[model samples]
Target: MSKKNKDIEVRIEETNRTIKGTNYVINQLSIGKKLVGEVMTLGAKEHEAFLGDEDLGSYKSVDLAIEAILLQHNLHD
Candidate 1:
């Protein structure tokens, strides 16, 4: 967490869930305990990013998915 973005606090953590034989970890993006988005692995190299209930898009990696979620959340700082 950086102090530069003081308006909201962003946090991502692992969840106990797996799909399609992929032991994926769902990162819940939250702002001060309020969940705004999520990122999870679909299978192989495919990852899914979402905001609220809307699908942001499919990504190739977890980092990319997180980036998309952050961009959609407008928390790029």
Candidate 2:
């Protein structure tokens, strides 16, 4: 892990809205003060499973992906 990873906390926020007459929840994630990303929930079970992860459950959206990418890059704090 690199210093950058240790300094960052990734958070995901869920938001719901209608697009083209369809309702969808968007997962918006913030990483420290640097990066942001989004993810889409396909089903309740899937979302719940995702939320079950100890390290990532609290993150609402793209935080998981961002964390994975950062970890892969060894960008730890």
Number of the top TM-score candidate = 1
RMSD of each: 5.2, 8.2
Lowest lDDT 10-residue stretch of candidate 2: 47-56
Name every residue pair that clashes in candidate 1.
none
Which model scores highest in lDDT?
1
**Which digits, one per residue and each the tens of the lDDT, describe model 1 over residues 1-77?**
65574566678888957566767778888878788788887677888898888898899888898888888777633
lDDT of 1: 0.81
Per-model tally of clashing residue pairs:
0, 8
Candidate 1: RMSD over Cα atoms? 5.2
lDDT of each: 0.81, 0.49
What are the per-residue Cα lDDT tens digits for candidate 2 across 1-77?
65553554766677896879988776655566544444555455333112212233333334454455445335443
